[model samples]
Target chain A: MVQIPNTPAPTKSPAPRPVPTSADVARLAGVSRATVSYVLNNTSAVRISEPTRRRVHEAAKELGYVPHAAARTLRAGHSRMVLMPTLPVPAGPLYSQFVHDFQGALSRLDYTVVQYGATGLRGDDAARAWAELRPVAVLVPSPGIGPEGVAVLKRSGARAVVTLSPVAVEGARALLLDHADVGQSAAAHLYARGRRRIGVVVPEEPGMEVFSAPRLAGAREAVHGTDATVTELSLAYTEESAAALAARWRGLGLDAVFAYNDEYAMLLMRALQDEGLRIPEDVAVIGADDLMLGRLLRPRLSTVRIALPSGRDLASLVDRAVRNPAAAPESQERFVATVVHRDSS
Target chain B: MVQIPNTPAPTKSPAPRPVPTSADVARLAGVSRATVSYVLNNTSAVRISEPTRRRVHEAAKELGYVPHAAARTLRAGHSRMVLMPTLPVPAGPLYSQFVHDFQGALSRLDYTVVQYGATGLRGDDAARAWAELRPVAVLVPSPGIGPEGVAVLKRSGARAVVTLSPVAVEGARALLLDHADVGQSAAAHLYARGRRRIGVVVPEEPGMEVFSAPRLAGAREAVHGTDATVTELSLAYTEESAAALAARWRGLGLDAVFAYNDEYAMLLMRALQDEGLRIPEDVAVIGADDLMLGRLLRPRLSTVRIALPSGRDLASLVDRAVRNPAAAPESQERFVATVVHRDSS
Candidate 1:
């Protein structure tokens, strides 16, 4: 054995420094940063030899190089993230359908959808908290939130602010889904079906002010151009309350009812039936949101189908607005609603 | 003008170096580091003078001593965040109720709820992604995920992994909610009402396996224990499908039908009535989830009401488990289901 003079050299450790960066891979492969980027992103614009690609791949494998998400975000400036504030209002199948559509649409547009839990947080506080995440857009369910909150969110780097409300906000693009139209349409359908006195079910929940107010307004609006009178009846979402409403239907002189949504409509209809009232012949009933249960009824519940704007369209608009913050604010898009005639009405 | 620093002995600035630190407050208010911390944290054990407290607060305000969240988190060693993966199932009113109750329960326990959008991710990929956030617990809706996924989540530092599934994983706690019970109850209700031939509405959506399968199974289980025979019908949630089903209701010879949930139930009922079929007389219809619409239907929809475990209990258990990770894993918690008999059935 030849004895060699001891020269201090670094030992090759089994465990290497875990985090390998793109720069390290580039250095090992002897490639330009742009070439590596192009290859990594699968950009067809750059032309690289197969051998070169192989070398780059081998170097990346040897070093365990992975791109940093933070670095990518920093470069992009804005995240591909959409912040949806959780509505405190109870979400039903109708709202759920809308949400599902919205999410699918946004995902197709390559926008990451995030639903922030905002049960307790009020307007500005919720906005401030949401702003911390720096989302590109925020879709509010247009119930409790207003323009001031939208302004705060816009200031926090949100480019597109859209809300579903009866009235459009100043800064935000509104998907103005008129709840009044739902009521008006239902009333009109019932009226056409020879329903004279229409009873409107009012939910007795604290946070239902936004939903109830617009519906009442719409009911009044529909009756404004007709001889049919709309009577607002407060009812808790309970069997007893529904039973009470049904029992008093004869005394109220109401021939038909325009319940807020299918849920309320179903409840009132049941109570009326239990009270020995023959639907359509004695008391015609119309509902909003055109739920499936309405169709399964004995004298199927007639309903106003409030058509929601296509989720794809809304999501596309948000994407475009987010990309170009300088774009002029767009007006609220109104969707057309039609009444679906059934046995009840 | 009271400048006595002609020799440049010392310099004084009104604003304390922009951002305030504990040392700056201690020096300004003439208090120890420990005293300042006690006052700032509002520790009742400490008996600091009111005057000193005021001075310290003034000093902090002058110096702009905003508490750093990251630094605070670092000191705490664990996050107060609870991660709930978004349910892939199309949401409804029943889900909304659960979410509202769950959030309320969690908030009372001082846990911040965060809903993660889990559309594109599943299994280990989802676990690794969620784990990167370092959440203390993860509550996932069952069916879309499996046991391997749960294990992955557990390995990722999630202490309490609770899923709403009958299938339990090795390490995680399962909160089994028997959806089959909902189906069984709804079917039994119809049977007791003297309905013989029962039709179960199965949604023909591609991705609703988690929901539809369980409901179908429940309906099957109920039929198994009864004289009534269960007939499975594939129904797409559309006007066309409902109409078609209504046209064929007489041919099927079904006296009663469980339309999965209230939405489908309402849809089917309307369609049946459209074809001149009377509910409860021609076919008694029952739905699950006891949605508000069920009550609002003319002959209110008879439904199965599923009672989820009280969120307060779950939150408390989660908090305790998180605090004591070494403690034995909690036993499975079960939810109860019952029938809400109304006019439709």
Candidate 2:
């Protein structure tokens, strides 16, 4: 067995060979192309002979013909893509976690999460661009898209048109995250702590205005008719800007503040400290989006805890829409926002 | 324009209309489907009359038909999805910004970024699952994939196989990010500061081990036959864990530590401060990924700044690979990692 005939050992290139398809499987199985498709897809309606089914499976296995998701999607007149229009803001941990979980759930349900850059797209034009991809579903931001855009998406065969807001779109399912609740909860928490002169720091960044505007409005609404007063403060995310605001802290005379989110709260906290304002005595602060870093603060920052729907629930909803196609629009359910009072407030 | 008294105003539903195809445009233009496609796509190889091109454009515009990306991909026997197997770790700001720019670049180039959830998948099975989507390109993790998996993807129509590491994989392009450089840089920075005893933090998390192991190896290699000593420390992302490590910090006799990344560094920094440790006096610390929050810390954090390729460059490379499949593998160019000194270290 040691020394045989003089022959060269065979080698295989790393370059991949052409893959087998359903057509190849059908030819090998001695069946029609329709039969191959039916067997592979397990078409529940059409009955196939047990022997024919076995042959199709056997041939598919021998040729390594996995029914391609894209090809199958084409046959079904849809794309497997679930387009998530990227939000303008750089996603922090909370949003990142939500997306991560959602991705996991969708993957388990067999859908690809395609994050589309919609920063430059607006309204129907954005919808048109999105439609070009022929995505089966789209998770669009409510602020950037409206009824016309939704119509465009629907026309392009998007089965599930879900909006990222608490108010339901005319013909799409709403994920229903009410930012007002975040502001309201933070303001209410500060009020309960006996801080009446409240200040809401509205971020001056371009993309953040969508969130900051509603938050400020909600805070103002929460304080109306009450002893508390809600004042809006404009702030940018630079140290110089924070320092400038801190320098004029005494002139504003706000006792309590609802910073937009934890990041802003942290920024303002350092600034206020640099201005020599004592917490609770001079100013009390509460931020939304309860982040882990907030816990590491000296006085431990108080925050508004956001409760989002689990990935499994959202994924099931998308899958249902994809499967059922059309159904009566369900009423929007508000996500919960509760106050977590740490020493900062 | 005023509305007519007798005529009812039109309403648009969110549901989209069926998209028009090349055949529809051809019928209206009184031209062949091939002529319509060539004219619409601006196929330079085929010459057409100016009147014919104008007719095709007018017909397409009148019908409100834009050439669908999916239909074209189907014609080309490929999917526009560039599958990115998601990492197990929660995305920090560094990863988020990188992905954001990458997505923007890809979208501008008319490619979709499909972030596939591979937490539940491993090895060849994961590749098979990814292949089902028939992504034109794949950015796979080094540890999770192998040569067979790369082969599977190529066979399934994935035009480019790229790894996250700089080290080349069989038949795949690697996006060179060497963890050794990150470790060496951090350790070298600490050594230059005259800190002989250094502690390297290895996060006690499931997904983080892949990074932590290499970092530890790199640190060990950097200190080999040197006067400096590198000690390994296990830390979880919990307040209690950080406090426990801080409690033993005094006994460990370590003057400097290179925490895995910014998140861990921030967490440990707070714990150390709480335990009455003075920055740079009792112990100095450094982390990687120059996140925005690190700049906000009281004694501002020092970090390892990773300079990744511009998204435009990376996207064009991917597009080039998709366009030309049989090209030779390009030489690996290491991503630059440099130390950024601040108050902490």
Compute each candidate's TM-score over C-alphas.
Answer: 0.73, 0.84
lDDT of 2: 0.82
Query: Model 2: runs farther than 4 Å from truth?
Result: A1-20, A25-66, A79-81, A192-197, A225-229, B1-68, B79-81, B141-143, B251-253
**True-vs-predicted CA distance for residue B182, candidate 1, Å:** 5.1
lDDT string for model 1 (A277-330, tens) is 988788887777777666666677788888787767777878877766666667
Error of 1 at B96 (Å): 1.9
* lDDT tens digits, residue span A237-307, model 2: 88888889889988988899898999888888888998899875788988888888899877789999988
Best by DockQ: 2
Each predicted complex: what DockQ? 0.16, 0.30
Off by over 4 Å in 1: A1-78, A146-148, A184-198, A222-229, A276-284, A341-345, B1-79, B144-148, B151-157, B180-201, B212-233, B238-287, B290-304, B338-345
- The TM-score measured for candidate 2 stands at 0.84
| Model 1 per-residue lDDT at B332 | 71
